[model samples]
Target chain A: MDSIRLNQLIEENYQKIFLLALKMLKNYEDAEDATQDIFLKVYENIKSFRKEAKFTTWIYRIALNHIYYMNNKRNKEISRFPEAHEMRTEMNANPSSVLHEKELFVSLENVINLLSPRQKEVFVMRYYNQLPFKKIAQILGKSLGTVKSNYFFAMQKIKNDLQNQNLLEFQE
Target chain B: MKCIDKNILLDYLNDVLSSRKKKHIASHLSECGHCRRELEKWKKILDITQEFVDQDVKLNPVPPHAHITQRFSKLPQNDESSFWVRYWVKPAIATASLIFIALMVFFFAPKTVPELTENYYVIDNVTYTETISLEDRYLDNLETLYLQEIYENEELTYDILYGDWQNYEEVLNDLDHDELEELINKMYDNEIT
Candidate 1:
């Protein structure tokens, strides 16, 4: 029964979790290891679930905790994470704008890595997961306003940083 | 409506605002140039943010190796009673059986008779057999006397080492303690004198 549930969970969310770990760890092997470890943890701790939070949210929190632990264990190195502004500017500015389009997608990845842990979480849940603000608030245990504001702050920072670098031009 | 604050603008961009508030923000957008421009920036941020959203964040499938799931299934689940027993029991039993067989092989085997240590020589149609007393202890020095000990026989041929030699364990089983000691002392005396 536990294995069945674990398989179900992995099948459903493995990709998202992999993406999270990849973005967080910024390497393929580490992300794969983290994903495997995360599932093992879920299998072990599923009984303690208690249903206090949404399962998806609980899983995300577990993944986040794993990534955080790994980051700490690795001594908080962000060298693999590209700078937030540089990604945005490079993505938003291009010769044909098509260059910026592909670059933007890749750069967004770097930007997500560059975000502060809190900002990254909120941003990922909002954008990647497409999770509702209320759900995010529940998952984060933060108020709706707090969640919204954090997201706002993240977007604002990215915008300002990109603009300062002259990578993004807001047309008049 | 105080031209919808930045927070409201953000909420509006995220499409989180209620229908009525959406209408109010829309009206404010038409009237207030600053808010409209702020709204445009937020929209661009939204558009830019969409770049990440459209991306499919997928974990690469596990590489082809030994099956991880199969291996994991073989592991004992945590919920069973005596989970440790489930994990360690089979391995422990396997190890004990191996040790037991090894001990029996060590202590109960028949002893080699040093007087029956056949050394052979072939002379025309006749074969001569010279038996050497090789105590197990003298076995160590056999390498030094290997050339002199060579036996040529019709059945054994010119090769004293023709047939495969038994393992030391087999040799150990065949030689009794006293015979082994006598054989060793004789070989030592022969070497010295």
Candidate 2:
């Protein structure tokens, strides 16, 4: 593809891709690096893109792979679960409706981070990105049944965790 | 479909299920209070997650360094070094050095004795009854007796001395008239020469 096409792809998807990396990696610096790295890798391998899969799916695949690899490489890098808890406590301190949505968002993020990597990915694709299970399966290079199972298990785990944390009571 | 698996219900709410399946799961959700409540909880979670997506992630989306894209651009487009270049460099260099040394030795060394034929000699003089050689100098022959000619009446036996033994003494007992005449004529010829 020409530079113009590549530029358009980046302009459209840069934010989503950056958010995905940031969500997975937690730290801004790491997320930015990961994002840039992911883009560079995408640019490098753009020729290999098959028309059968969606571009978003391919980008997410690359982003997820990069996150896992980065996490695996540096054990000292902590998960973003702390921000989730911090935001939860921070949100409760202010009793305004404006912050209520943000608090719930933080709670959801916490719950997401609590999930195992596979389940978290499946959950993110299924719920956060609103991706279909078939596309999710393709991005994850797993069978559709496996994707379903991952999503199922992830929701169960989140339910259990929420119940344990007493966050389930807030569901109306 | 007995108790809506909360997970399946989540999929259902997302409209990810087929039409027939959604109807079947919806029936199960209505009949099952616990499943219904769980599904509500998940809907809340999804709503919360969507809210998070809308909220500012509180991150500087601008990459830390302005030159990050530039850095990325400069990274080796292809990481592979040429295969032959990596492996053949040392061997090619060594081969060149070896050829250089061989050529030096071939072109710069001194000429050898074998090239000049310095070990041979030639001798000319007389025939011998036996193979004979001088004591010191190999160029001289050392036979003391030789037949110069066969006469009608008899053969003349003369002593031939070579090298330092050129002074020779004859040991003949009698001399015939022809022999005497021959000896006399030889002596006379010697005197005249």
Candidate 3:
């Protein structure tokens, strides 16, 4: 791909990819760095991208792989620094007594962050990115059943968390 | 006809189900209070999640930055000959050396097929292979965490280049111990530097 075409692709995808990285990494600076790195990886490997696959799907695959890698590294780094990790954990442990909109949002973010990696990925892609389950399956290289199962599990977790926090009313 | 599965309820809420299936689900939901209640619960969850995502996106708008494109422009263009040299020639040389070493071992050493009884067990008169070797298990663990290593170490760019992102698991699994160790060492070395 020529520089112009690469630039075009970057311009088109910058926000979507950034939002994905932000939601996945849950840190602004890390998301910014990841967005840049993801594009650079796209640029570097543009030559190998086959024509049959959609560009969006291909780019999403790259972004997701990079995000997962970064998230894993971040988790390992946190494990190495127990004090700081404990402090962050303590902060999250104290849920607000009042379920204000802002508090609800915070609780939602926490609930999302708590999801298992597979569930989180599927949920984020489905909810935030608005990617269809088929596309998510293609990107994750899993079956549609697997992707939907992950999303269902994630929804179950989020619902349980919200109800536990009294952010949403419990239903029988 | 039956109570809606949670997965199908979610698909219905997300508007991703086929029109026929969706209409069928809608009809079922109307007739069944239980399914309706289940759908309402999922709907609430979806609404809250969507609202939170909308607010988050609005709060964290992407700042204007032109440097990303500039960096892309600065990247060196693909060179065909260099690609072949880096990916093909080097691997060919390594394979040839391994073959040479194996040939020397074959010619110089007394070779006997070692009995593999310890690695197999009889189950219902069927020989079952034992668990994978320790080294294979180690490599399996490494492959599981290979994505982390790729991001932690920049030196694995070659691995990225050689493997398509879609098949990263397979590609990482194919990496031998020597390569994985070298990559891990490079990651730590870079961190120290």
Which candidate has the highest TM-score of all?
3
**C-alpha lDDT score of every prediction, in listed order:** 0.67, 0.64, 0.78
State the fraction of real interface contacts model 2 keeps: 0.18
What's the CA error at residue B108 for candidate 3, in Å? 42
Q: What TM-score, computed on C-alpha atoms, does each candidate reach? A: 0.54, 0.52, 0.59
Per-model clash counts, in order, read 7, 0, 0
Write the residue-wise lDDT of candidate 2 on B17-49 in tens digits: 889998887778778878877777888766755
Off by over 4 Å in 2: A47-54, A76-105, A170-172, B29-34, B56-193
Better of 2 and 3 by DockQ: 3
- Please give the range of 10 consecutive residues that has the lowest summed lDDT in model 1 chain B: B117-126
Q: Which candidate has the top score in DockQ?
A: 3
State the lDDT at A54 in candidate 2. Answer: 78
Residue A89, candidate 2: Cα error in Å is: 19
Write the number of the candidate with greater DockQ, choosing between 1 and 3: 3
In the predicted model 3, the residue pairs found to clash are none
Residue-wise C-alpha lDDT for candidate 1, range A11-64, written one tens digit per residue? 667667766776566556667788888877875676676553377888887888
The DockQ of each candidate is: 0.13, 0.13, 0.22
Candidate 2 CA-lDDT value = 0.64
